[model samples]
Structure formats: C-alpha cells, structure tokens
Target: MTAPEDDAAGALAGTPEEQRAALERWRLVLGEPGQSVLAGGQLSEAGAGRDAALDWLYGRDEDLERRGVRQPRHGGDGPSVVTTVDWLDDITTLFPKETIERLQRDAVERYEIHDVVTDPAVLARIEPNPTLLKAVLRTKHLMNPDVLLLARRIVEAVVRQLVEKLATEVRHAFSGARSRTASRFKVARNFDIRRTLRANLGRYRPEERKVYVETAYFVSRTRRHLDQWQVILLVDQSGSMTGSVIHSAVTAACLWGLPGVKTHLVAFDTAVVDLTADVDDPVELLMKVQLGGGTDIAKAVAYGAGLIEQPRRTILVLISDLYEGGSEHRLVRLVRDIAEQGTKVLCLAALDEDADPAFDRDMGRRLADAGAAVGAMTPGQLAAFVAEQVGR
Candidate 1:
C-alpha cells in the first residue's frame, strides 16, 4: 500500500531486514566502497547478480592488478580502458536509461575515448550519442588529417539529421511572417476574403440573394525575402560549452539557409573566429571552433556589433554561460547600446537540451534589464524563437 518513494525510503531506513537488503543493493552499485555498508551481510542470488553488474562498471581491483597500476595520475592515462562497446552494452542491459547514459558519459571521461573513436573498429563498435559526438568534435584539433575527416563526416551526419527535423517548422514560422497583409489600394495576390466581405456587405442584394462584387479580393503572391534580415550567432567556445558549440553550429547553418536572413557565426574564447564564410557547411564551421580558452565576451559583442549595418533589421543571439572574462561594465554598456539602437538582442544562457544549466544569473538579469531576453533553450526551441522573431 506504500508509494514507490515510501517503499524506497522504507528499504533504506525501515526495519533491519529491509536496511540489510538495501545495503546489498548499494554494494552492487558502489562496488568496493559499498561493500563496507554490508561488511558482515550477505546477498541473495538475485542480489549477487546485481552486485556483479555493478562491479563490472565500478570495480577496478582486477584491472589494477593486471595493468600494475592504481588510479590515474594527474594528466596521465588510466591503467587500462574498459572497452566502450562492451561496457555500454553491459550497462545498457543492467541500468535504467538515464543511469546508463550517465555511466556512458563517465566511461568516456574516464577512458579518454575521443582519442580512439576515430578508429574504424572503435567507430563501428559503439553507438555515438550527443555527448560523445560533442566530445569527438571538441577534440578535432588533436586528430590527424584522416581521422579529422572521419570526424567531420560524423558531425555532418548528426547536423544533417537535426536540420531535417527542424527544417519544416523553421520554414513554416519564417514563411508565416512573410505573409503580411497588403494595403487595400495595392491588391496583393493573397485575397483578404473577410475584409472584402465586410466592405461589400452594403452592396448585398438581399432580394436577389446576390452579393455584387465591386472589388475583387486577390491574395498576395508568396514572396521570398533573401538577405533581408541579418542574424548573428555569437557563441562562447569555452571548455564548459562544448555541447552548445556543436548544436549552435548546426543551428547557425539552418539559419543561414533560410531565405532573407544572412547568418553570421562568431565563436569566441578570448579570440574571435568568424566562421561566416563556412556558415553553409556546419561541419567545416564546427571544425574551425577552438573549445578551450579565456572568454572575452565584451570584445566578441563589439565584433558582433560591428557586423550590424542596419540595427533595425538585425537579430543578435549571444550564446554563453555569461561568465565574462573581459570587462563586465563594457559588456553591459555594449548590450544596452545595441538594444537602444533598435537591434533585437537575445542572450541564451545555453543552447543545449539540458534544461538546468550553470550560468551567471546576475549577468542574465543585467542583460535582461538592458532589453535582452535571457534563458536556456534547446536548438529546436531556439529555431522556433528565431522564426517567431522574423515572422514579426
């Protein structure tokens, strides 16, 4: 009759039997460390199976003995990597989906898997998720020419898939904006049927049951606005933003392809690299991104401002954690100046799928007070926001 949460709490803090059972479960998950909780306790056969699976992931006793090493030293490699494919496959069966994902991420960080992922055998053996994919792209600078090319292919595939998923909604939102009503004097191809009906109601011949059409309602023909609006995707390429960098690159490419919008992507980390020329190719654009460096956000903001020829027709999207390494006062001043000049500025705390991101709330508030909209959003949501902005 107890709720699952209550059952869980009972297992951990209930009767002695229940506590012992829960301790056995912990031993399975925490391995050697967990064994201390159940030092004199024993597990049932089923519990033993669970313990073995946990040991497979967290236990390093056997691995240490074989490799003749303890834990990894600072800036040094681990004793020996547990093969990614084997570990992931095993954990996938044993753990819940979220737990499996967490374990996989841990394994990646623990094993330095990105360095070897380019190998044909390794690439073929594992399923690459977003986190791993981001890691691969992040390490492109260290890869050889051949391996780098393979990494680009992987990035392109992932980006292409995202584009496919987002293309329809983006086009729809953008097209809806271009469907503005034409002036009454100038007959647009799109007919204003309701308006025409209202204007001609007086001319309705009730006796004959005929409404005479003195004026024809012609719908305005669809117009494509190529290079009419400018979109600047100013991304922060610091160490913590690797995932954001990858997704932002792909989103920038999508924005670039949309008619009537000229998209410019500038990635910053103390230095700015304008990848506008390669905007059409997300793969190439992402390859040029350098992930770890100090952040000079004010300078990047200044550079982005310089690109705006017409502030009224531009949208500046600044993606970052908002930990400004440069002058905060100057950054605030610049943002306020741009907003006052009629530029539509949006400061995204992050542009990744993770809902809760660690960002500077104080800075976000300051930017918002200065007329910038600040929040964390996924790429798809960002595309939707862009579509809404352009549509207006």
Candidate 2:
C-alpha cells in the first residue's frame, strides 16, 4: 500500500492506470484515519459524483461491502461517521460561540447531520425518508479537502446555510449597524448612583451605592462602533496550506455570499490568480486552482492591494507560509503602503491549516511594524475576528 505513495506525486494528469495509481498514492497519505473512513463507504456514499476519478480515492469504489471492513471493524450499519464528525469538530472549534450554535443548527438541518452520525434518533428519522439520508451524505465534510472535489457538493447545503447566516450577520452588523453600547458599557451607564440608588432605598446607602458603582466601574465599556469593511483573503495554494487553504477559501466564499462586504479571494504560488469571481462556486475555484508553486507574498499582496480603490475600509488578510519568490523588500514595501493607505492590513503567517514554519521572521516583524499584525489563527478565531472586524 505504501508503494503507491509515488502515485500522489504527479499533477492531475496521466491515463486511467496512472490516475488510479495516483489516487492510491494520495490515499496512502490518509494513513489509518483515511482508510477507516474511506473503507466504510465514504467514497461512493459521500464522495462520488463531483469528480468520478476522485472516487478512486482510498480503495473506495462501487461496492464497499464487497471488500469488507477492516482494522477493529465494528459495523452495525453503514461506514464509520468518525471522519466527517472529526472534520466537523475541527471546523466547530474554528468558529465563535454564536457562530458555532449557528453551525450546529446548519449541520443538523442542512447536512441531516443527525442521520450521518451513528445516532439512533437520526437513523429513525431517515430510515423512512431516503432523501434524508441522501442529504446527510451531501454535507458530511464541510472542511475537509482530501475528500476530492466531487464530494464537496455534499457540503453546499450546510455551507450555504452557514455562509448565508454568517455573511448576513456580519454584513448587516458591519454595513447597517450603528454603534451600540457594549454590555459592560451598558452596565456602567446603568449603574449611575442616582439611578440605582434611587431604586434601592435603604438597601443601598450612599457609601454602599458608591462602592457598588465604583466596584462595578471595571465595566467601563465604550461604544466601539461596528464599522463597514471589505476584506480580501488571499490564500496560499501551495501544498503546505492545502488543508487550511481549503477551509479559508470556503470561509472567503461564505464572506462573498453576503451583501455589502466585498470579499475577494486570490490564491497564489509563483503566480497570482484572483479567485474573487470563483467564490460563487468554491469547487470550481479549487478545481481551477493548481497547488504547488514557489511562494510570492509580494505579488499576492500587491495584487490584492490594487483591487482596493478605497483602502481605509478594506481589510486585507494574507494567509500564507511567508516564503517569497519575489523580492521580500518589495513585499514589505507593498504591505507598508497598503497600511499607509489606511487598509486594515493583516497577515496570517500561516492559517491554522498546517504546522510547518515557512515564514521569514524578519519580514513578518517588518509587516507587524507597518500595522499588519501576523499570527496563526484557529478557524474559530479567524471566524470571530472576521465577525468582530465586520461588526457581527
């Protein structure tokens, strides 16, 4: 099985045999987790239709029952739901608390999530309704890239719901919302001695009320207006960020789904490819993208900056490994200029996709000084930041 490792080597080319061999090779990358899920009917059941060739992934083909399950196999019915669940868990951790609730709801209804997991209630609901199970299969993995481009369709139902919710929430919050006093700030204003003390007669003496208001003074919240903004997330399509790239791209797509917020995505390696239009169909966006090229942070950033005619309201997020094929200084200069232009510039040295260090510390520091903060952001943190930045 390991011998097939070479198959994942070449690009998306070659004959049937080579393609099959390549699928097998990439399948090897799945290791045990990949096998467990794929072996359990994930391919055809959850991974078919999009790209027929993608069906070749991980020994999963037409009839899963034919080969039989393997390695601690305990199948009461259907393949293991662990893979999809695990992916969901990862994505769950990437969103904010409010967003997570929304995501959970989306997963449950849109993906028919209850049916996909080995839960009895879900099985009962779908046992009578076949369409329910079909829906479940569609949204099994919203954040996994290895599932092949074809399998991505299953994610649309849930993703669309989630994206719409997030986009709408964020867009409305950013574009239409007026600054409201924060809860803490509200607490502060409400704690005026004259107001609270008047309500609480003998229960609160002047000193007591003073202590109360002063003690609660820590809640000095001010009105931090939710501002309207446009964000362009440029993801590095290089192999390193493959997992994160997929997740972030989907995140970017969801942003595009909303009104008001101008979300643009440009994936890069040696050359820059503006994926703004492709956000409408993430699968096509990804298919159109071919990973593995030299990193050119400057080119990618500069391209994004050019798209922003009005910089002050623009939020530019560069998700990359930070290696550069182009001149590092030019990239630094571009970042500085964008910051000077009043763009809310930020560079994520590496989106929480992979954990291989590929950034230039000196360059990262320079960008930081230019007002572009750099750090790794978990998916949830990224989501929260996006929401907060846009006033969601």
Candidate 3:
C-alpha cells in the first residue's frame, strides 16, 4: 500500500531518507497519535529520545487533557520514566542548541517544573538564558547552598549579558550629542567625520578624488546632566513581578553613579527594603531580592518620596502591576501629590524584554489621571526617558 501523502511528506517527498526524516519530524510535532500515520508506528532511537524529552515537558500541560489527547504513557516495555535530569540529558544530547533551549524554556516557564533549576545536575547541564534566570529567581529559595551556588553562575552569566546590552543604551542616552564647534582634543571616538569633511572640502583634489585635509575637526563630548538628580526606583516584589524585579536591578546598576544622577533601588512587598547599596552589583542585588509577597505600592512610593533630595529633579519609577494591596486611594493621592510638586512619577507595568504587560488597566488609568505616566517600558526605553528628563 502506498503511504498517505500528508503535508509533511508531500513537501519533502524526494528520496526515501528525506521522506523518513520529514515524517519523523511530523511525528514529533503531532505527538503520540502521529506514530502510526507518520512514522509507521516507530521512530529511530534518536527520534524516540527526542519524542520522550518533548513529551516529558509538554505532557504535563493540562490543556492536552482537556483537548482529549491522553498524556504519553511510559513503562511496560516502552521508555523508562523521564526524570528531570534524564530528560535534560536526553534533550541536550539529542537536539540542536536552539531546540534544546526552547525545550528547556518550556520546561521551566510553561511547565513550572522547578526541578529543572532546583536540581544541581540539571542546572549544571542546562544553558543559561533569561528564562532560566527567571526560573532560578522564582525557585532559588527552594535550593540548598550547593544548588544555590550553581544557580548563581546562571544569574551572573545572564546578568552580565543584560548589563552589556543595557550599558550601551545607558551610555548613548547619557553621552551628549556631538557639538558643532571643533575641539583642540584629538580623540578618535570624538572625531567629527561630517564636520571634518565639510571643513576640509576646500582641499579636495578633483584629479585624485580624495580630500587632502590640512586640519581634522574633533567635536568635544558634553555631559548631559549638569545638576544632581535622584532616580528612585520603587520595584514591586510580588510573585507576578519577578521579571520586573530582575530588570529593575539591572536598570539601577546601569544608572548607578552617573555624572549627575543618584539611583536608589527600593524593593517592596508589604514593606519596603532599600537595595541601593547593592545596586552596583546586579547579580548580588538580584540574589538578595525576595520575589513573592503582597504588593504595597503606596508604601513603596512613600518610601521613594522620602528619598527625594530635590522634588523637582527626582524621577520616581514605580514598577508594579498596580494591584495595590495597600490603600489605593492613598497611592493615587501620593502619586498626584508628587507629580504636582514637579516630580516625574512613572508607573511601569512591566520592565522586561517583551514589555507585554498584564496589569490592572483601571488602576493604571487612575494613576495616569493623577499625572503619573502609566505604561510599560523595556529597560533601554526607561533609560532614554530618564536621560531626557535629566538633560532637561
């Protein structure tokens, strides 16, 4: 009997090897039901390992049960039970780097399989990425000292990547635009190519089609901030705001010790804790953060307001979902009072890479009405806003 021509088979229906590989891929995608139709009731040994690794993570999804797809059953001569470490091993060994990373992300983020990070064996094997870093933050309390030590490597690696990425944005925002006037200093980075070309245009030789420069124009770099300004970052440490907490720590670290800005990093749940001392070390700051509790945004905001050296020059960034566990009326009134006094109040719903925030819209609108800017922003965008405010 001729094999049925499904989309997978039809698209790659060439040699027998290509057809088999495509069908195996489709089998993996379709789960257990695709076995008989796509792979003819069997998969190669590597294919079986890959299938088991995927099933280990995706099989726990309750939606599959609701969709009438039964979870893949093991044992009774099938593959053995896939422990977290074993699954990690199988995926890292059987899949490519990209596929392995995706599987690892699903295991921790979508499945909430804490063992992926909590287990030292798995932590040692898994690649360090943002998703894994978040998982570590959420579950770090569950780890022993040894596992926590291993988890710190993931934190450091991921935080270093974030700092490198954000530091560039911070530098650009704070680095003043090139001045039009020429400078005596001859720094290579401050070289004004456009101004130099314009200035040396008189010496251009038509025969050689090259400009013979008698003088090189170098523009002096100006500092954006002239007066001292305080940046009070009141970050909510509720369970839902872990991503925000991570970004806030990194943002504070990037903003620390600028020419004219003093950064205060305060984390709040029911109570507020000042984390400014640790702001220079984001890896340490993030390690010290407690990521789950009832949110008291008003209390945090009040604490931040107290830290303002100059009300007119301060930028109070309240990073939370606005699900206030404290008095909502007090929060709105406080924000309005601060904004009215010339303080820049920014209520960030999210401060992560995606910036896709799920926050209380009504409360956000209420804060906006109170003169506080309510929106979601990534770390880079927040730096730019702060830079603009400081420059002004």
Best by TM-score: 3
Tens digits of per-residue lDDT for model 1, 94-189: 667777666656555665556445564555544556656776766777777887766666677777776676666566656654355555445453
| Candidate 1 RMSD computed on C-alpha atoms after optimal superposition onto the true structure | 9.9
TM-score of predicted model 2? Answer: 0.49
Q: Report the error of model 3 at residue 278, Å.
A: 0.7
lDDT of 2: 0.57
lDDT against the true structure, each candidate: 0.74, 0.57, 0.88
Give a tens-digit lDDT track for model 3, residues 1-392: 55543545657858888888888888889888677656445888999888877877888888888888894444588646668888887887899988888887887777788998998888888789888998899999999999999999999999999999999999998887455667899999789898879989999999999999888889776668689989999999998898899999999999999988899999999989999999999999999998887888899988888898889999999999999888999999999999999999999999988898889999999999999998899999999888877776
User: Model 3 misses residue 140 by how many Å?
Assistant: 1.4
Native RMSD of candidate 3 (Å): 6.4
Which residues of candidate 1, in runs, are more than 4 Å off? 1-53, 60-100, 110-120, 178-227
Judged by lDDT against the true structure, how good is candidate 1?
0.74
What's the distance in Å from true for residue 186, model 1?
26
